[model samples]
Target chain A: MSEVATPTQHAALAARVSDACRSAGMVGAPYPGAVAALDTLGYPTTRQERWRYTRVTRLLDVSPTAAAPHTAPPAVVSGLDALRFTFVAGQFVGGDTLDEGANGCFVGPVSVALARYPERLEAWSHSDFATKEWFAALQAAAPQDGVCILVPAGHKLERPVLAHHHMPAGVHVAQPRHLIHIGDNASAEAVLWSDTTAQSEGMMNAAITAAIGDGAHLSLEVVQDEPGTVHHMGHHHFTQGSNSKLTVRTATACAHWLRNDLHILQDGTHADSTFHGCYLPNGQQFVDHHTRIDHAHPDGQSDELYKGLAADKSTAVFNGKIMVHKDAQRIEAYQRNSNLLLGEQAAMYAKPELEIYADDVRCSHGCTTGQFDKEALFYLRSRGMTETAANNLLVQAFLAEVLDGFRPEIRDYVHSVYARRLGWS
Target chain B: MLKIDNLHARIGDTEILKGLSLELGAGEVHAIMGPNGSGKSTLASILAGRDDYEVTEGSITFDGVDLLELDATERAVAGIFLAFQYPVEIPGVSNINFLRTALNSIREQREEAPLSGKDFLAKVKACAQLVELDGKLRDRSVNEGFSGGEKKRNEVFQMAMLEPKLAVLDETDSGLDIDALRIVAHGVNSMRGADRSFLVITHYQRLLDHIVPDFVHVLAGGRIVHSGGKELALELEEKGYDWIVDAQPTEQA
Candidate 1:
């Protein structure tokens, strides 16, 4: 993609995407609404209020399906001990880490799922998004290779599943879509991480559509630790069933331009949903998270907390909204966004909003932005810690609110991974 | 042993400690009683190497080393501890983690290997017991949402754990009731030894009744105008600081 690409160029790129789908024999099949949406909505511009903090014109010219850079499969992810489905530069590399899903779980490339379980693949291809979710629609229109994970009803996985994405050298763009469905009474946890050793800076516009059945539980963690030169935009949509539980933690460790949109629908009564995130952006890095929770049924509950740590000319944007439909009575929703600015030029924009139509429901939202406590810093330094150590401890303490939301089994592992990524441990 | 000679410190050109001089001997408990804004806290903070105030002209020597040249952590590793007048609340940093980090850092400063987890936990338990601190508080954030009494006790617990050679108590008795004051005083007294010393700074002489300072110094007008033995605390308490502060100008005139 060329920098300073125009919207008209993106409109042409949208046409190229439609033609690519047609020639690839996916014209009538796959998700047509997404292709239609992309054709109608092109891409966002800074003129829009939500796109003020992010700029995508530089990435608008990525030639969809750029050939994968010739490279070896990454071996570093082998120790994750999950059903690993590796994708490099928008193409599926043969899995040496895992061949097949274990114990009533199905994990494989999306094309394989399309060939084997076409009906289920088609069912989850559509997103429940009404607004112009440009990235999600873009991925759907050009998803050449991705992962599909399914946990059949009445089955529980003993291990967490991991889907790792790596972009090899010289690739300009990669658009991969993922589908995860948890059947009734099923439970599983999955972690997705994206990285790059590639030097040719580009973008990755990925999407994941997850559906949870009645009384099922699913926990998902998305870790973005790409080099600061790369751009990333991701969308995750979750639809829940009655009494089901869903928890998601999105951690943006590093990226030059990172934007994530999480849309959750509590469609069934008594469903519980939790959304927690931590974003640390430093030195020209930009991270944004836009989350919306829709309480569509009575007695549904949703809680969200997102914390940002920005330093050294970086910026963090958070907009979390909870909407209670007119018929969705007895809903309980809470949202909070907190930010800590550690550098002189570091900036943060946080908006936590609540819209309730039900009179008797409990709803609250708050946002806070500030620098680290000077008194706390002195207290730590006076106890024999150097300035760096004290700063590390304070940042860790700031992020502890979101870190405590992970499950017990993955809590320590996640914390260590994040700490290492942040150069704190 | 610590010595302060002709110490003069200020913040933003306003003098706080003006040519103040004092000496602390090993095992000696000295109390510096002064009113608010009289530089009581400023003296303790300066001893702890707080950088907000610049020592305009003075020298502070700790154990025959120039304490003025050392940083805050260096001062801490060199065995100077300051119990803050208003303890800070650090959310999400558990007391256990903070204490463990501090203990290991101190050991590293001393060129000693870190202790095993079991040994460290045992030591922490003993120190908590010494200060009558609850074990549950150990897992909670440092001083976050803690009662005033708990925060003060945590300070003493920290003092017991680090076992500093010189303990500077800055208003350790400010918000304490009679009972808390006694417990805190006992915690401090228990750690007193032939090689350990204390410089207790308080606005009231009541704390000296429990800790029983060996020397009482009257700090007024940014100087120690009077020095006496322990009985002097009662005399100052009865007559109040008015007479002493009142006499400074007349004597100078």
Candidate 2:
């Protein structure tokens, strides 16, 4: 298939997108450069080697109309003792919904942080993926509204900071951006959830740039469950310093189609990174994850495990690569991707690659894609379980290896979501 | 009580059991001893509703219900259990969770309330002890990385938990050490009662020495050529199956 769109169409879409970004107050007001990069990337055609199997042109098919800003809806989540910020139709409506406990951190809006704590925006400018990845750069230049989080040095936030990027009830382009910084010896947890309203239709292209300073610990989770016609394009970039620990989990349960990009750079020695992804897509939905983890210094460690279940003609893709620099001796990197197809039409593609330049480093990658074991199915059924229960048992068990490591609160919530997705609720 | 009449079964056009017939009364245990490829395992599999074997001609009645009409899970709910010779290893399904799910499935069919978590745990611990299964292993995945003996013992452990009306043991004694065999035999013996019937199929008469079936049936070439009491097993063990196979032609004549 040829990606032969007229130049006029590209120029027109770029001009409109750039205008929206400037009107929404892009960080650097560099929409011209973003338009130039978008020209080279050209809307993620399947012709690209990395996107050979993932069909993403359908996401770009929707006409690019700027999402209309609306009044924030009443926040629905409670009981979580975290600073909660909600953006209504890609616009932050100003205050924290949850009761504020003063965690010595900022959670609300990028505009407020840029106006106040300008120091946090410094890390945003140096994102490892923004210049390298087209989607990251586009999101950086075209965010309608977003969240900025900053945890100061030597102080650990006792409460989590939660942000919700809410799209409104109509066809529109939604670009949401987030910048997070954890200073030296600081610790914090954050959650980014994007959901569209009923009858909503559009493309939600979002990006996150996070930096963990020396000796800092951070846990971040990203969840995308949009309603009808909402295609998701997400970019997550992480830069870790010496002795820092960062754990990230991306759980995609519901979406029309999703393409997620994750880039992790271990800039300093002794940094540790863990990436866990669980995707359960059913009934014509698509979920693809492309991740790259780079170990630039000695003693850096990274572990990645991704699990996916495709049912009812759904498709899932996982392409993960871990690279160890020549100087990064003694670094240990491990990656494994496991996929299960529930029906004949359902499909999964898992590709795991390891590039090790250091002779002394330990690195391994494994990819497995298969239907449920027939013997295991028969064994469960022979024990009196109905076919559905047996199938659910096996599916849950296949995913449990990854889910078991999630923190208790996240695990319980994720389990509930998964159960509902399995039609148990 | 269980009865099979004129059973003709085949796997992929190859008949495993040809015109075989057997019966077992309530409160009785029957042992079927046969040489290798004599269809001992096939009979057990057919009784448990394995789909690979096509029952060309047969009538199997279990507890007054037509067993052939039911699927494997339905047969399980109807109180039929088969102990696999090679128990499958399931990595993600925990032993305790699988047992509870299976037990609850059966209970649902019988219109019984599901066992509470506390009660089930108690029952599972007691049953695990019967087969000498380590308490810690119950929390692990079913049969995954278990020793050969442990897999066989796990089968009996699950049997004790399900409490089926009819239990078919197929080569359960295979790959077991003497001590593990003793433990398994003890578990089977503990589950035996007036209402339960068992079909113990083994290549060796040694397992019968422990279970002590009331009747012994010598199967040769897919047919029961001889039937007698427990002494028949010892005689076969001593004289060998060659004597029975050689005498079968003359006995039929």
What does DockQ come to for candidate 2?
A: 0.72
Clashing pairs in 2: none
Chain B TM-scores, listed for every candidate in order, come to 0.97, 0.97
With a 3 Å backbone cut-off (N, CA, C), the pairs that clash in candidate 1 are: none
Off by over 4 Å in 2: A1-6, A15-33, A64-79, A93-104, A123-128, A416-425, B246-253
Going through the candidates in order, the fraction of native interface contacts each one reproduces equals 0.72, 0.68
A214-244, model 2: which lDDT tens digit per residue? 9999898887767577888888889899999
Output the number of the lDDT-best candidate.
2
Q: First chain of model 1: TM-score?
A: 0.89
Model 1 over residues A1-425: C-alpha lDDT tens digits?
Answer: 22344667877766665444344333124466776787677477777666766777766655545455546456544556677777775567766333233445677777777776666655655676523676677667766566777788887866787777877665356767787889898998888778776364666777888999999999998877676366787888999999999999987766778899899998799999999999888778888998999998999888899998888888889988898989889989989899998889998988776788878798888899999888788888889887767877888788888877755434455555555655667
Angstrom error at residue A212, model 2: 0.6
Best-matching candidate per DockQ: 1
DockQ of each: 0.80, 0.72
Global Cα lDDT for candidate 2: 0.81
DockQ of 1: 0.80
* Deviation of model 1 at A346, angstroms: 0.7
> Worst 10-residue stretch by lDDT in candidate 1 chain A?
A21-30
